[model samples]
Target: MDAAEALTLLMSPQGRVDPYPTYERLREHGPVVQALPGLYVVTGYAEADELLRDPRLGVLDDALRDQVWPNWRESPAVSSIARSMLRTNPPDHSRMRRLAAGAFSPRRIAGMRDVVRAQAEELLDGMRDRAGDGAPVDVLADFAYPLPVGVICALLGVPATDRPLFRRWAGDLTGVLEPEITVEELAVADAGAAELRAYFAELVAARRRTPADDLTTALVQVHDTDGERLTGDELLANLVVLLVAGFETTTNLLGNGLVVLLRHPGAAAALRADPGLAPAYVEELLRYDSPVQLTTRTTTAPVRCGGLDLPAGSTALLLLGAANRDPRRFPDPQRFDPTRDQAHPLSFGAGPHYCLGAGLARLEAQLAFPLLLRRLPELALAGTPRHRTRLTLRGYQTLPVTLGTPAVADRGTPAGAHPGTP
Candidate 1:
């Protein structure tokens, strides 16, 4: 199939289940292929990896913004979004990333190691308390989703009591984040955005009145600085992006990782036997099937990829899912081998805009996986798992699992103690 044909499949509901084959076809055709007028998709590991680090490719483009948010062409709020880190280029992107990066540095995230593990255990404990001898538990609902949500809540200083509300908002935002959706879904997304903005506005007010020692508190302090901080709208938009992106991606990582282990009983047994294997398993899971399937970028100048000349101002959607599986980069691309010697895939992205929350994300996965498996050794799929209707973020929507009745260890140490202990 041609690039256009593959893109059509991507936009269709059927493609949501499995975009890998289509991505492979696109890669075979060429590294760069136009999806539509002014829209191109790149599926090669080398090309996508290079473009992510290129100085010429700009995220903030008037032409692309016109295409993406046509309704907000004349609105200042859209302009604020245009100025945010995810949408900007060069110095602005650098600045925004730097500010967010400080709070998410390896050192800072290291401090949260215990917090993440504790949150995971707490969430799993809740599920166990509810589950009978062989009761079915949704891994997504009972464990994956809530674990990361709690960690992010603690990270951003959001009240844990408001988790249910945040969960709803995250769902609505994820729907719109998908490249293809019906007009009604788009309207729902707009409404969801409005609701999020309103909620953040109030939350910011509360934080301003009484500052706490949390990331959100620090962000509000940034605003108080002499025009060096993100604006109110920028804060809300980025916060929404951070919360949604943070929870959605990690939740999928945990879910997809377990799915991989379950499918390969050998690796599952190995992990259960040796908790230390969890980190390596996490890396393998990212390589085998990443949560972030693709991302979009645009060229500021004409560039040749796969013998094709893509003109300036054209869209480029990098298929991270395909590139991670590229035969050139990864031998035996289709297999889920936890012992593969390849470097971890570009799941957290690369270059100037590489994910800021990567450390925290990895910590969450490393800690959550083994603890989960150890706690529920008899966990198994209860039904045919169904994935969320999202192409960009790939994960199960409902992963029904029959978990073993977990017996708690007497006087368990907190989750963070393991990493810190000598």
Candidate 2:
């Protein structure tokens, strides 16, 4: 397929289901191909990595959006995302990112390791309890989904009881991240954004009233030595961004990681044997099936990329999934080898706009995966797994699996022992 066709196919559901072949085609044509007028798609790893870090390229924020799509601000969902640090550039991006970094410190994220383990164990215990029913459990709902949501909620100081609310709102809001979204989806996302804003506003006020040892409280009170900090609106917008971003991508990572593990029995067995290998395993999983497939950036000045000269005001769609699998950067790129000694994947992105929650996401996955393998030793697919129909976010919507009875500690115990047997 040509560049245009390949780009079009990526927007189609079928292509979303499997975009690798199209990516290969795009890569064969060139590392960066002009997919359409004023639009380029980057398919190679080195090129994408360099372009992502290029200062001349930046998120299409309000000013750029106004020039490209006049009615962009009409959609609350779109506007919400546009205002986030993900879409801002330079001064605004720097300010907001610094504030967020202050609150999401490494020490804070490091402390969540134990919390991640406990939550993982708790979810697996629930899955184990249901194993006796001879019914398939959805790994997405029972484990992958809850683990990240729970961790993010705790980090944000949101009540665990309100997780269902966040899930509903986040589910609706993420539709805006797609390459193309329907009007109905836009309406749903808009409404969800309004509700989320109101909800977080109240929560922020509560945190201000009663300070707690949580990120929200810290964010609410954070300030630079020069008295620079997030404005009220910036605070609200970023809080929403943090809550949604904090879980959405990580949720996808957990689901996709589990699917990869289940499909690779040897790798899973290795992980089960040596839980310490989880950090490496998670890295491979991120490279193999990134939670986010594509991210867009706009050119602020004329630049040369992928052996082509592009003028200012151009848009580039960095096909991160394709780049991650690019053969030039990854030897045997398609192989799922945890032991592969390779540079970091562009999964969490690169440069100034790199994911603020990358460390937390990694910690969650590193801890969750090993715990999952230990808790669900005989976990195997019970039915065909289904992927979410999202071009930007790639992950399983439903991962049906049966947790076979856990082996007994006694060596003499017969195989296929009753699931409930001690």
Candidate 3:
């Protein structure tokens, strides 16, 4: 299949289910190929890396939206995304990113390491109990979903009780990120975005009234040297971005990582034995099956890339998943090797728009994976995992797994303790 055919297939639901083959077909055409009028697709690692960092290629924001689709802002879902730092260019992006950076500092992320491990252990214990009943546990619900949500909530000073609500809203809102969402989905996304905005507005106000040692409080009080800071709308939009972006991608990462680990028993065993290998293991997991499949950027000016000189305002869809698996970049790209040297996948992207929460996500996964494997040594796939029907953010909707057997007796015995004695 040519690039056009491949892109067509990729936009289809079936193609989203498994787009690797389509990516391979597109890559055969060239690193970068125009799939449609004024739209290019980058399937090679080098091209994607370069384009992601290119100043000429920028996020398609409201200004660009006006140029492309006259009625773009008519959709609330689209407008909400447009306001986010995720889709903004330099000045606005830089300001928003700088304000949010304080909360996600290395110090803060390191402080949360213990918190993540604790959450992981508690969830694993619950999974253990569920497995004791001889019923399969949905890992997505029991473990992957809750762990990241809890961590992000704590970071954002969101009450733990509101987790279920966040999960529901996040689910609806994330559909907006997909390329081919239905009208019904768009309606739901609109409602979700409005509700989320209102929720954060209240939260931000409360933070101002009584500041706490959390990310939200920091954001509310943060100001630049010249007393510049996030305006009300900027604050609301970015807060929504933080809350949703915080857990959504990490949830997918954990889910995808577990699936990969379960499929590769040797890797799982290795991780279980030496938890210290988690950092490297997590990197490999990310590269092997990235949580995010693709991201887009538009040309700000006429620029040459991949031996092609394109006109201004051209859209380039960077296929991150394909780039991660590009043979030229990664030797034996398909293989899952935890000890792979210098594995720097574009899963979190690159340059200015690189995921701000990348470090936190890495910390959570690094801690959670080790804790999980150690606690649930017998974990195994109970049934076929169901991947969420999201092309952009790829992860399991329901990952059914059996925790094998309870590592501890039900009679209030600690794990690894002698049941009869203790």
Candidate 4:
């Protein structure tokens, strides 16, 4: 198969559970391999990092306008949603990012330690109660999926009652980011986007009538003397961006992290014994099995990456998963090592478009994982987990698990689980 066709198969749903081998092959061929016509794939850590920061590489820049077929151009709904930082370049991207940064500031996240812990504990409590004598429980459904969504909802001032709809919208809409999408899937994503927008539109109206001390309210009212206020479309777009980024990414973080732990029982036991290691464990989880596996950038100007000349108007797909496992940058890269002293993983991305919700995401994962383990020390996979049918997102659709005996509260005592706690 040609390079492009190979990548197509690798990104197909049939290969969703294991795309690493294909990534390795591509990396071996060249860190910067041309995947298809007018597109380059960067699999090296150094190169991906540089391109991410390069001014010539952008999202939805003029380059797209030039190359895109008229009939295949982004729909109005898609364009509307893409106006956020994820799909825009600096200046406008920087401005929109800064507006939301304050709410996700490290200080704010630090202050939320108690809140994160409380929510995690509450969620775990419910999970433990429901898991009677060894019943097969879906960890993704019971734990990972709910934590980040709950946190984002609380932060966005989204009413608790309305979260179910947002959850469905996020699940369907975020699938568009996958590398290879079928026409039917694309249509579903488009419909989901429209529904999400309509839902948020009503939400915005409600919030405008009765302002709450939350990110949504802050975004609407935040202004500079120079008259910098998010426009109506911008507000809706950003809210959608925040919702997807804030929840879905971290949902995968938890799901993927659990799978990593399952693969390493010794490390799991170690973490269970020393809860203080939670932060490092969480960081390592991001590196070991990143939630986001790839990112797209189109060249606005000809540039050289990995000693290859990439022409203007070309697309560069950064293989973050492969980059994270590059042996040159990470020794024994395939090994899952929580004790490794890597500075930071590309899991949250880098440069101008680095994930804005990084702090909140880390906080939620750090708190949630330990609480989960502490609550059920004997947790093990109930059956083979089915990963989501998504290429961009490295996460599970269901994580069936069985819990061990539960311990006491606060004393590191494992929660008591009924016989066969699944």
Q: Rank the candidates by lDDT, best first.
A: 3, 2, 4, 1
Candidate 4: clashing residue pairs, number = 16
lDDT of 4 by residue, 1-422 (tens): 55677688677777667878888878876789888888888888888989888988887654464456343336433554566677777788888888888889888888887776777778788788888766878887777877788888889998888776766777778777776667787777777778877877887777779989899878867631233556676777788889888888999999899888988999988877766677898888887788999998888889998988999888899989888888778888889999998537788888888888988898888777777777787788887898877878788888898887877764332345222111
Estimate, for each residue in 1-422, the C-alpha lDDT of model 1 and write its tens digit.
77788888877778878888788778777776777888878887888898888776767566667776676544333443454676777676776676677778888888887677677778887888778766788888888888888888787888988877776666765675566667777666666666766777788889999999887778777877745557665677777677777798998998888888878888888776666666778888888889998877788898777667778887778889888888888888899887888456888888887887777778888887777777877778887899877888899878998887664541244343453421
In model 2, the runs with Cα more than 4 Å from the true position are: 222-228, 407-422
Which residue pairs of candidate 2 clash?
Answer: none
Task: Give a tens-digit lDDT track for model 2, residues 1-422.
Answer: 78898888878888898888788878878999998999999998888899889999998878877876799778778877877787789898998888768556788877666667767777877887776787898888888888888988887899988887877788888888887888898899899898888998899889878989887887788632233566666677788889999989998998899888999999999887766677788888999999999998888899898898878999899999999998888899889999998448999999898999999898888777766776678888887788878878888778899888764332211244332111
For each candidate in turn, the TM-score is 0.93, 0.93, 0.93, 0.93
Residue runs of model 4 more than 4 Å from their true location after superposition: 62-66, 69-77, 222-228, 411-422
Q: Rate the local accuracy (lDDT) of all candidates.
A: 0.76, 0.83, 0.84, 0.79
TM-score of model 4 relative to the true fold? Answer: 0.93
lDDT of 4 at 120: 77
